[model samples]
Target: MRATLIYGLGDVRVEDVPDPVIESPTDAVIRVVLSCICGGDLHSYHSWTDSNPKRMGHEVIGVVEDTGADVRRLKKGDLVLAPFTYQDGTCSFCRAGHTTSCLHGGYWSRFDGGQGEAVRIPLADTSLFRLPVGGDSELLPSLLTLADVYGTGFHAAVKGGVTEGSRVTVIGDGAVGLLAVLSAQQLGAEQIILMGRHCARTDLGRTFGATDVVAERGAEGVTRVRELTDGLGTEIVLEAVGHMPAYEQAIGVARSDGTIARVGVPQYEQAPVGNASLFGRNITLTGGVAHVAGYVERLMPAILDGTVNPGLVFDRTIGLDEMAAGYRAMDARESLKVLLRP
Candidate 1:
């Protein structure tokens, strides 16, 4: 079996690794069908300094190859949506729809990488959502979104309190940012200002329901967002760029008493959250790792009914052996998102 491993900063490789097998009663082995790269993966691509390489990739769609004795909800041949994290469904946090905090849950990279031939899924029955579609469906790409990006976008909108006729600003034009625009649209936001510099990506943001696009950064970007909102800023700000600069922009574009939902994996430890930032405006800080397993069912119906196509975010596809090039393409900003067919 081949899997991606990150040896250090900017170094990603596809190397042969041992096959996965069921190690616990709650486990299941899956043959990966489709996987994709995420912006969060770039955080590691930029600054991983560990002595040994770590497994890479989390979002995956796979078919059940084997199951442990305790696994009842899945069987061989079942195509499933494997969210990034695996959790025991009955845990208190999972019951509250916060699967990311499940007592027995953790991310995929802890063991097998999604960008591989196969993976052993822990807490199988609860973590893997069985998709109604089959392996060869044209909707696979969209269904794959339930694994990470799409749901993450929705988490931002939901946590930020986006609602009907709400005014919103989304920072970043990456897949999550563009999809956050889509999520705000689905929630009926009347005004969506997308702050991105890339024409191609910001163009997609517009198509996803951004009423205006601000192709600026720093103070200039804040000025543009405020101008679009009559110099008052928006009711909700979705910060999808995990960088410190984007965080500052989110504060700038957030109206008094508004909400800032940060879905991007934070790249820094210290940030402004006091009177100089959120406290001065009475703004609330929310959002964290998305509970994709919890969001899969709610978001799947729209895709199943063909009401929306979130898969447009994926701009490239490669084989398992081509993952090295895939990482380069994404790192260099030549690809919006890369899909892997293994």
Candidate 2:
């Protein structure tokens, strides 16, 4: 089998690797049909300095090839959506709808990255969600987004308290950010403001539900958002860019009582969160890793019915061997997202 490996900064390769096998009673092996290169993957591809090669990818939709003895929820030939993080659905956190924080769960990459021919999923009964239909469904790409991107975007909107007639601002124009715009629309936000510089992305944002697109950055960007919101800023701000500047923009554009839901993977180790920046305005900061497994079931119907097509984010599709090119295209902003067919 061939899999993607991140050797070091700016280096991604596809090389032959041993195929995975069920290692636990609850484990299942899946033959990947489709996978994606997430923006979060870029963080590891660019900054990881470790000498050891790490398996890549987390977003995947595949067919079950084999199942462990105790795996009852899935069987061979079943098509399923594997969330970016694997979790034991029976955990307290999972039961409470926070699967990302499950006591016995971790990233799928820790076992065997999703960007490969096949993967061994632990806790299969609780980790993977079987699709309503099986075998090369037309919704494969859309279903693929449920594994992470759309669910995470939906999580950002949910955490920010977006509702009917609410004023929303989304930071970052990446795939997740665009999906956040779409999610905000689905949640009934009357006014959606997207802060992005790229014309193409902002255009997609508008299509996704952004009523306004602010192409400025930093203080100028904040001013633009304020001007659009009558100087009080937006009611809900979705921070989908993991950079310090984007975080500050989210803070600056949030109203006094507004909430900022940050779904972006933070690049900085420490963020300046203090009374002067948060308490003074009475703004609530929330959102972390998304509980994708929990949200998948809820969002699937919309995708299946063609109501929400977050799969549009996949601007390019390539074979497993072209993983490096996919990374470069995403990093260069030449592609919004890349889907890999293994």
Candidate 3:
């Protein structure tokens, strides 16, 4: 089987690798039908300096190839979507809505990443969600988002307490950020302001539900958002850019006593969180790795019903052989997101 492996910055390779097999009773092996590059994957793609190559990819929709004796829920031909992480559904964290933090859970890219032809899924019964739609369904793209980006955006909005008539400002216009705008819209937000510099992406953001678009950056951008809100800023700021400047912008556009929910994988460790930043203004900071598996059941019906189409984020598609080119497209911001067919 061929899989994607990153040697370091800008170096993506597709090479033949050994096939995966079930090693645990809770495990199942699936032949990947669909997969994609994630914004989070770019973090390692940009900074990986290790001598060893790292496996890449997480979001996957595949057909079950085989299952261990204990994996009773899935069969050899069942279609399923594996969230970025695998979790034992019986754990304390799983029950608390923190499926990403499950006691026996771990991310998919650690080994046998979904970019490969086949993957060994641990804790299969609870981690892999069986899809109602067929593999050839046009809904495949939208169903795939339930594995990461879409659910992540929903996480940001939910954490920020978006509700009917709420005023919200979403920072960044990446896939997750744009989806954040959609989530806010679905939650009944009366105002959705999207902060992005790219006209193409911000336009899609508007289609997704952004009532306004702020193309400026830094202080100028902050001023634009404030001016839009009668100088009060938004009550909810969804920070989707995980950069220090983006954090600053979230602080800049958040009304006093508001919330900042960040879903972008942070690129840096330290940022302003003192009195001058979030503390003095009574801003509550929230959001982390999305519990995508937990959100799949809740968000699936919408996709199946054609109520929303988050798959618009995948602007390009490539075969496993074009893995490097796909990465280049995404890193250069030439593609909103890249879908992979293995």
Best by lDDT: 3
Clashing pairs in 3: none
Candidate 2 TM-score to native: 0.98
Candidates by TM-score, descending order = 3, 1, 2
Local distance difference test values of all predictions, in order: 0.92, 0.91, 0.93
In candidate 2, the residue pairs with backbone N, CA or C atoms under 3 Å apart (3 or more residues apart, or in different chains) clash, namely none
RMSD of each: 0.9, 1.0, 0.8
Model 1: per-residue Cα lDDT over 162-245, one tens digit each: 999999999999999999999999999999999988888898898899999998899999998898888999989999989899
Model 1: residues >4 Å from true position, as ranges? none
| lDDT score of residue 19 within candidate 3 | 91
Model 1 scores worst on lDDT over the 10 consecutive residues at 104-113
TM-score of each: 0.98, 0.98, 0.99
lDDT of 2 by residue, 232-325 (tens): 9998999998999988898899999889999998888787678878888889999999988899989999988989788888889999878999
